[model samples]
Target: MCGRYATTRSSGTLSQLFEAYDDTDGRHRPDWNVAPTKPVPVVRVDDAGERALSLARWGLLPPWATSPSAGARMINARSETVATSRAYAGPFARRRCLVPADGWYEWARTDGGKQPYFLTRADGDVLALAGIWSVWRGPDGPWLTCSVLTTAATGALAGVHERMPVLLPPTRWEPWLAPTGDPSALLGADEEWLAGLEIRPVGAAVGNVRNSGPELTARVPDVPAPRRAREDPRSTAEMPLF
Candidate 1:
C-alpha cells in the first residue's frame, strides 16, 4: 500500500549505496513524490549475476497483459500470495529487486480529514523495500516494470495502517535480491528494524503528487481534531498477511 514515497538520490549515489553498477544510463532524476506509472530506480541482478541499478516503471505489467494500463492496480503485490499469484509468481522466484526510498507516506483517517505521515529511518538511512519485477515486451519494445511487496504492519506502524511495505534490513537485502531463496522466510517484519523508523506527521502537501521538495517531508503540527485511539497492538498478530 506504499502508493507514494520519496527517492531523491541520484543513480550514482544509489549504485554506491547498494553496491550495484549503474545501468540507469543517467535517466534517473530526484523524485520526492513518486506516483504510480512513473519510472523508478530498482536494484537487481543482471544477466551476469552482478547487481545493477536500473529504472523500471512503478507498476508491474505481466508479460501476458494486453494493455500497459493494467499496471496501475499491480503497483503492490501482497507478500503472502506473491509466490502463487499469477502476475507475481515468476518474478517472485526469479526477478526479485530492491526498491530504494528515502521514506514512504501513509494517511491516517481523522475527523476533519486524512492526515499524512512520513515514515523514515531514524538514522536517516534509506529504506530498501522488497520488490519483484518483470520485463514486458510491448509493441514499442521491452518495458521494465516492478511492484512493491506489502505485509501486515507490525510494531508502531500498525496504528497508522494495517499494511506497510516490506522494508528489508541490510542483512536481509542480499538474501532478498539473491537469484533464489524462500522469500517467505524474509517477509516477516523485524521489530528491531521497525523500531528504527521515525514517523513524523507531515503536511498534507504530500498527498498531491505535483508537490515535491524537502518541504514535503517537513514536520507539521498535529491536526486539532480528535486523534484516533492507538489501534490495539495485539490485533497486529491477527491481521491478515498482505
Candidate 2:
C-alpha cells in the first residue's frame, strides 16, 4: 500500500509532462511526506472528456458514505478486488486518474529492524501511480477524493513488500483512462517494464511528517533504524497502509 510519497514538481512542469491543462486552485507546496486526507495533485479526464490537473483529497470517499471521516480508511484500493469492491467498483470503471509522485517509501525488514527505503525511477521521471477518484456531494459543495491502487509486488519490488502501487507507463496512460467496461488487460504482468526503477536507503527522518526538507530523503549508509521517528504514531511516511 502507498500511504506516503513525495511530489515536488511545479504546476507548469506537470502540465507540460502530462500534456494536460491545469485546473487546480493552486500549486501544492513540495512535500517530502504526504499523508492520507491531505489534498494532492492528480491528473484526470473531466466531464468534458479532457485531461485536467486538479487537487483531490488523498482518501477516497464513495458517494454512499455517510461522512467524510470515512475517507481516512479508504486511502488505498487493492487491485485484485478494485473492479468489484463496493466502494471502488464505480470509480474504477469510470473515474480513473493518475497520481503523480517523485517517489514512494517502503519499509524493508532487515536483521536490525524495519528500514525505510526510497524508490524512484533511475531516470528521475515522474511516476503515474494508477488511481481512481470520486466526487462526494454535500450541503457546502462537492468534495473531490481519490485512492491509490496497489497490486501484487513484482520483480525487484517484491523483495521489499508484498504489494506496491500500480504504475502506468507513458504509452499506456491514455488507454487506462478509457471508460471501458473492463481494463484488466492493462494490469497484466508489468514487472519487467519497471526495470528502470532504483531503490536505496534513506534517512529515518522521513518517518516524521513534521520533519521536512531534502534531509528527509537524503541517502544514508546502513545503520540501526532510529526509534523516535518510527515510533511516532502521527508519522505519515512510516505508517503501514496495509
Highest TM-score against the true fold, candidate: 1
lDDT by residue (197-237, candidate 2, tens digit) is 77667877888877767676677775544343344343233
Q: List TM-score per model, in order.
A: 0.93, 0.89
Positional deviation of 183 in candidate 2, in angstroms?
1.8
The top-ranked prediction according to lDDT is: 1
- Each model's number of backbone clashes? 0, 0
Relative to the true structure, candidate 1 reaches a TM of 0.93
> In candidate 2, which residue ranges exceed 4 Å CA deviation?
223-242
Looking at candidate 1, the ten consecutive residues that score lowest on lDDT are: 233-242
Go through the candidates in order and give each one's C-alpha lDDT: 0.87, 0.81
Write model 1 residue lDDT over 1-242, tens digit each, in one string.
Answer: 88999999999999999999999988999998999999999999999999999999999999999999999999999998999999999999999999999999988876667888888887789999999999999999999999999997775577677789999999999999888778889988787777778777789889888998999988787454214324454433322111
Q: For model 2, where is the 10-residue window of minimal lDDT?
A: 233-242
